[model samples]
Target: MSYIETTMKKLQRSSPGQPEFYQATEEILQSLRPLIDKHPQYLQQNIIERMVEPERQIMFRVVWHDDEGKVHVNKGYRVQFSSTLGPYKGGIRFHPSVNASTIKFLGFEQIFKNALTGLSLGGGKGGSDFDPKNRSEQEIMRFCQAFMTELHRHIGATVDVPAGDIGVGKREIGYMFGQYKRLNGNFEGVLTGKGLNWGGSLVRSEATGYGLVYFTENMLQAHDDSLDGKRCLVSGAGNVAIHTIEKLYQLGALPVSCSDSTGTLYHEKGIDLILVRELKEQRRSSLIDYLESHSDAKFTPIDQYPKDGHAVWRIKADAAFPCATQNELTLADAKALSENGINCIVEGANMPCTADAQAHIIATGMHYGPAKAANAGGVATSQLEMAQNASMIQWSFTEVDKRLQEIMKDIYQRCSETAIEFHQPCNLAFGANIAGFRKVADAMLEQGLV
Candidate 1:
């Protein structure tokens, strides 16, 4: 067997039951075949083995009380994946699905994602399996405090600084920040996604979505096309999906569909961004609430979805952005999208597409943007927040956004140029994996064994 294959077997044995982490690592290793052949130095240094291992993995039990005086227990995790390039940077997700497997995958993906940004960031991820969906504010605040009470010890502004993901947001970050301050008695930029009045940076909330669209525009502009009048399919009703819809509208594209955990929404007339913000950001209701406004729109619940694939990808569109969770788009979904002539598939969520799905899209010559490169905007903006915090300053919305746009363009160039260099032009997944890995691997080699 090949070295990459051997490494995969060893990882399976070492990190058992971590399929998501393995999937992510496998994708990168498989894509690096060409690069490994070109430069055997990385292999000689055994960078693959060292790179896959985390610097530190902390798991703790969180005990918090609800408003009703009932105690709840949840498992908290913080995986410091890497600090080779700079400080560890990623997000802390609060969802029922969080575990070592999920966080490891996210942190592994973040290592390359941060590298693609060309920023001084390493990789880390933390979270708890505390479902925050219907919890009261008091309960959430209590839980956030408990989670951070332990997480604060392993993280700092110069060490591992986490941002928000999935169920964790501004309010959660605020509670955690307060707890961190009370414990350490030192106020610092230990976390991103803080409230605007605090040490937060402008354009941070909209960075990932705006950056995804900017990357897509760069991809299209390279081929003499644009997002003008293009129809889009966006999945997920969270921050990334919501902002992606907003920026797609700004770029003259009609984001016709968006999905939540419960169902999928398809409005041929275009999604109402204002209503989406109200339902998701404010009310936190299901997409079914949207049909009350437009009877012509279609809603597909999870139970009624096609057995082969998700209902969202079956719709016809010019481009598709799977901004939901990992492994959302399967091979069937990719085939359905291709049948509908959806030529561009840019991932806004980490490892959103299945291996077969991603391979199929790229093999079909689709203008594909991998999540590590496409979704690096959020983390890049987080680094900008770090800079602002260290300097005790913040930039205006326009200024931060301009820099974000430029960064997206630069990332697109790096991926596309690397693809051409490797004789795999337009296969951005390969390009991104190679480019991101090379940077981290080189840094790891120079930094010596840790």
Candidate 2:
């Protein structure tokens, strides 16, 4: 058998039927196919299989009292995937879409993303299927407290530090942190996305989105290009999307599209970040609000984004940043992008692109980066927040932001160098996979099959 097929067969043999974890590993492995011939050591150890599987998977039932005086039970999970380099560090997402498969995929990706940060953090992730979409504040608080009541036992500051994801924002984090404090009776940096009034960092909210832009900037520079005068499309209206829009504006790029779960709004001029922040944060309104405010913009239903019920890749642009959930883009979308002449894509959300879409991006010879490497700014800043909490000090926005830039640059260098070393130039997925995989694998080797 060929080396690639053999390696994949070995991984399947070792790990068994784990579709999500397998998908995460296959992308990295495909990129690293060339490495098998030179460094047979990687194949000998079945590193792909070893790293694809989590160290531990915790699934529990979170029973809570709703504001209506009724008890509701929801399934919760915390996938502590790896701790090879350091403690398990990742975010806790709370959305109805979360499941075992979803968490497994996220946790597996976290291992490499954390390693790419150049920090002493391993990879892990946790969350639940309890959707906080329209829940009352008190309802969310009770849920968070109940979730933490059980979760506090499995995590700690130096063990597993989870920040915020999808529906787990500052409010959710505050409730969880308070519950942890009440249960444990000790104050520590168990959570990374805490309020600044407590122990949060200055740029924590902006880190992921801004960090995405930073990575894109570096990629563009390598191509002898820049973000200046580039028209772009960004999905999602959350923190990452908003901050990414702000950063895009700051760097003179026009972000023309943004969306919520309900719909997508596109303005030929550009999206107004201030209005978007207000709509999402204050009113919790949809993208239609922007169109209502400005006559120049157009609002379309979510599924109708491409006008023919196809993906929106046909929309011409210099860059595409998918900041929404996973598998948002399909193979048709990738083909549309290829036909339309897209320049590059950088994921702001974890696994935002399908395997086919990713292949299309690479097949076009466009600059592409995976979420683990491209969207690592948040975790890098989370580690910084941990340091601040440990030292009992806070840093200015400028100070934290400077450090964030340096970390992103360093991550870029890691991916770039690893790709070049393996004679696979510009293949960031391979570089990131190998660079991150080697670090954790070595650590696991040192710790010995536990």
> Could you tell me the TM-score of candidate 1?
0.99
Among these predictions, the greatest TM-score belongs to 1
- C-alpha lDDT values of all predictions: 0.94, 0.86
TM-score of each: 0.99, 0.95
Who wins the lDDT comparison?
Answer: 1
Task: Give the runs in model 1 whose Cα sits over 4 Å from its true position.
Answer: none
TM-score of 2: 0.95
Q: Candidate 2's residue-wise lDDT over 146-257, tens digit each? A: 9998899999988999999999999999999999999999899999999999999999999999999999999889889999999988888899999999999999999988
Give the lDDT of residue 125 in candidate 1: 92
